[model samples]
Target: MRVDVEYLEYLWPMRHYLITCGDFKGTANIIAVSFCMPVSKEPPMVACAIGKSAYSCGLIEQNGEFVVNVPPKELKRQIYYCGFHSGRFVNKFQESGLTAQTARSVKAPIIQECTAFLECQVTQAIDTGDKRLFIGTVLEAYADEDVHKGERIIEYAAGDFPRQVYGGRFA
Candidate 1:
């Protein structure tokens, strides 16, 4: 199959929320964008591409702590709102009507609305073209109690990506 380079570039839009704990204040802010979990379990890490001009990227670099809040498919509108706005200009939690709490290990805040949360400590940061690759190690993780025993957890994807329901194992 011949893939058109221009069309392929427009094929997918990645969507995710990057929450950080600020050093000066106790507030937690978020940036919504498309991110990837490049590695599965090797050292338990994930990567997020943040544009150089984004406000959240600066916070992540300055603090070296953040949380990846994976919201369920139901929060599609909230996700879109975060992805499109700047945290510097407005309080995302306030605008999105989301509540936040401090993370156990990292200074970053976690979105209580998410079905799952990943607390991360920045391990490395490298500039990749127009965006910076913010890589972090997962220090802690948790899932919502209500959805704990479900056969699958539904999550939304960016761009033309379809909603995904992933199964989980309980301990």
Candidate 2:
């Protein structure tokens, strides 16, 4: 039997990534995002959706850059923490204990705990009702050599990783 799922549930089980915004010598934030995907290849581009009111959205708008950090299953708890808390009030980097290191292209920092990262400069921002779609041109991308060898790398993050199943989302 096929039961109806929520509109977004149809896209459930998407890989979650930690999106860091802001730059060195200033404020920054970590937000967990699952609505992320590759949208181009010529120059390499990615798209991620953020709530219009999210703190990350504002930062991206102000800075025009972001870093997408791929976390492993080991970071499930930190992922949940960043997803549920608002960066406006909480220092997710400090509270979640995720390190923010400099990115090669973007001013935004990448999460040190993550195994891979993509630095992108926002090329476009489109308003889509309650969510804003940010399309970014990849400026830099890297993967841990060990993880790149395909050794114990966990698969894309599961939807039930304490997300809605636990009761909250990034604000």
Top lDDT model: 2
lDDT of 2 at 74: 83
Error of 2 at 96 (Å): 0.3
Give the least accurate 10-residue stretch of model 1, judged by summed lDDT.
162-171
Question: What are the per-model numbers of colliding residue pairs?
Answer: 2, 0
lDDT of 2 by residue, 1-171 (tens): 975444565456678899999875577899888889999998999999999889999999999999999998789889889988998899898999988887887788888989889999999999998889999999989998878998856665555634363223331
RMSD of each: 8.0, 3.4
Per-residue CA lDDT of candidate 1, range 28-134, in tens? 68776565565558789988878888888888888897788877767778877887788888888889988877678877678777878888888999999878988
Candidate 2 global TM-score? 0.89
Scored by lDDT, model 1 comes in at 0.72
Show the colliding residue pairs in model 1: 14-34, 15-34
What lDDT would each prediction earn against the true structure? 0.72, 0.85
Candidate 2 colliding pairs: none
